[model samples]
Target: MKSKLNLGLLLVAFVCVLACGPKKENNETETADTTAVSNEPKEFGEADGKKVSLYTLKNSHGVEAHITNYGGIITSLMVPDKTGKLEDVVLGYDNLADYQKDSPYFGALIGRYGNRIAKGKFTLDGEEYTLAVNNGVNTLHGGKKGFDKVVWDAEKITTDEGEGLKLNYVSPDMEEGYPGELKVEVTYVLTDDNSLKIDYTATTDKKTIVNLTNHSYFNLTGGVKGDILGHEVMINADKFVPIDSTLIPEGQLESVDGTPFDFREPTAIGARIGEDNQQLTYGGGYDHCWVLNADGEGMTKAASVYEPKSGRLMEIFTTEPGLQFYSGNFLDGSLTGKGGVAYKYRWGIALETEHYPDSPNQPDFPSVELNPGETYHTSTTYKFSTK
Candidate 1:
């Protein structure tokens, strides 16, 4: 009877161990999967009869970004708030069809020339070049078929910092009345530190003009919960480029002191937005470029925004010379964005880092020319945190 009891006890102990072993293993696997970084690509439909794909990048911290090779647009960016909840912060549409239809450069890569060119024409090396006039009487955002409307080749890559998506496009000479066959490469890396870093590099076979920037409409209230008028903004600029009634730079830099353009300190976006000012009326809101302060250069802090409701803070750093602060004055309720939300006036803000608008026309402005054997390179970073 004692030998039989000992055998039964041994069997019971073995069964318990087997049952508990697998449960512990499964829990460990689940944890690993949750924290792992991933770069996933899915078909986003086609543009110009070419297959386009959307790439989703996630960092170890669970921050996510969705980008499409169709115009290298950032369709969605998920960030964490003070409560540790992730929410989409940028404005965009749900599908590729909406983006291709009537997007006002939403989360897109702007190129060739970022802002406006006076009268849709410029003289380059004793030769006259005419671009497509889309914005009033000026050439806006590279022309009708800008970089934001084309398909790019994309590849997922991993670096020591984090996972990245590399997008490449080759603009033929005079594709949109531009000069050179420009080979452009842009890489977006979602770092573990909760920053989206964009690095742009371009080389041209012929001497041509080049200015590139990303237009990501941001509403830090987590998916346009409300308008961005209440957000506090601070731009490190002492002077700004004033625009004419046509929204083209007047070829002169005016001091921001005592003007509504003075964002040297943190102030609410709508504090003086309704003031009786000519520049304000000309732009319909804040759609001008701010010349960054001279604080050493390369990768300096360009601007910072704080949203009180969500306790979200976004800081922008760039190597560019100018920052365009667009108050989204043109975002009427005509277009519906992600989650079927209608984007209204002042619903978003765009901080575009680049050279001054119409640099080709304003000879005094920083040159946007790229000669043969010379490479054009720039970097911008959008860092997020909870204050």
Candidate 2:
């Protein structure tokens, strides 16, 4: 079933009601609605009574990104191909007003753990901790008020690599039932080579676990229309973690050699997405985490995606060992997006570079432990170009 948000009809009704008002003499306070539609920001008051600044990044090739302090969201990412036509490849709202209310994670940083926890419960050192359960029966993306919902502290930094932006946020001790006062720093650098390098660093006063990733729903065809099912994708993975109905890994490393999870060879995203596979049915589409063919440290190629229509290609490089490929199966057309367009199923894809989901719960999975006096450092680079 498809649905649409009738905001346009409501706006027309509002204008009609205003037109019936008595015409009065000129009054300073009664000017324009002031909230009239404009690309400019519409402030719905302050958080801590402080102004939040939005930042933009443009390269010599004219590629740019609009990022804001709130949730460190990527408002837009404009890139051009061989034809020199610019298009925003990221799916997002028109302004901060929509972002502050309801949003589907969108292009925001996710943390203290990027995926899920079983029943919002986990044990560490013989102690059990129950977290905020926001996703059905499980704890998803940290919780209801995860990092994606917070106003991160933003800073612009210039490095030899290129122009960069850093977002810093501190997770208090026992916050979200996670131990330690964890300090996190996420740096996003747009290099001259058209590579978006994200560097993550963190430290904790006590023992704590952390896995961070960006939740940017991408559609290389500019995200204006259509589904990403036709895009050819390839992930350098030989293994994938199988999940249960709750989308939590079952502590088993399954080989992708004979399954649809095999992306070692290029294949259309929708080629086997609709198969009567148990995992696909549970997720409603592809939302599994593949164990990347990386050394689990340093920089390495994780995955690559190509859209033939736009000749746009994206390569995912990361220091992490897992990549979560999410087909936008949950997007229902109820919310109006940028330019008043309704987003539909498979309208975007999110390639989240992070550790395997529920790593802390699985002893065999890669360790996400960040202990005292040790720094947690990781980086991922998304290089864009034309095929």
Candidate 3:
């Protein structure tokens, strides 16, 4: 009778295991799912009396990132180099106050209009609006208080591809002299493929202009440690916009043939930056925008940068029509950054993907106008790898 009871109990236990799996296994799976879902952002700072948060994203390959709601800035991006070592490749301040106080837009999101608008004025729909001139005689990066200076609302987002943050902000009408009540949504995703993708969408109640781009000063050899002069660059552009003495576009898409601006091949950034060119003289370095060579942009290769020492390669793929390659000529070692490092001139580079600068003033360039009922959307990805 005892043997019969033991056999019946063993059968019941086998049936339960088959039906419900193992309790330990179920608990382990639940714990993993909970950990991923509960990845909360920490309180970073306060801006305009609103709370600002910073999100930390990581991939299975150990690539980690820290982004803040204030300016949607990427404070740190650590990726593995050829030596299988991780390094922070972007330059940024350690605190929010440094960004607020006369920053160079390091790792921030530029928007409303990413570039200049010529003399701080533009006529849209027969109404001329004058904007605040911050960059000499032009309205730069959506005027004085651009999107880079504002605090946005951010939430963690996950997809089958990877993890990211969805940021939302509504720019009031004429917040920076732009003409609309613009609702903007930006998503920054760190994919498993070691790429950072930025997706932007916006809609305006009234007709307004929008040109958004991330301004990340990448050194590749790690941020602010050395100049990017040794980095090799290739731009998929046959033509580039020539800037005036004040660094505003001269309204011409000049051919890059036989000029230092030509980067059809992988060329060192400092190769011809000091060549006797008038355009180079005006900007003090490679600060102009190049018109991307695309058949009809779905997503095309805009540019690629490679650092030899670290063997870090970054390829820029975007739906935008232009690439602004700023060689960090304006960074003058005036301030200290993360770990008390002073950022000097040409220590970093920005390959900002966007529409042409001063597009409103130049009718020949691509349109940036987002009217009512029209959704403005664009995407840019920076793929990193060791070559």
Q: Which candidate wins on TM-score? A: 1
Candidates' TM-scores? 0.91, 0.87, 0.90
Model 1 spans > 4 angstroms off: 1-38
**lDDT of candidate model 3 versus the reference:** 0.91
Candidate 3 clashes between residue pairs 3 or more apart in a chain or in different chains:
none
TM-score of 3: 0.90
Q: Between candidates 1 and 2, which one is better according to lDDT?
A: 1
- Model 2 ranges with Cα > 4 A deviation: 1-45
Runs of candidate 3 exceeding 4 Å displacement: 1-38
Q: Give the C-alpha miss distance for residue 166 in model 3, angstroms.
A: 0.1
Model 2 Cα lDDT, one tens digit per residue, 73-180: 787888876587989898989877788777888998888989888888888788888989999898898988888877778787778887778889998998888889
Report per-prediction Cα RMSD to one decimal: 3.7, 14.2, 4.7
> What overall lDDT, based on C-alpha atoms, would model 2 receive against the true structure?
0.84
lDDT: which candidate is best? 1
Better of 2 and 3 by TM-score: 3
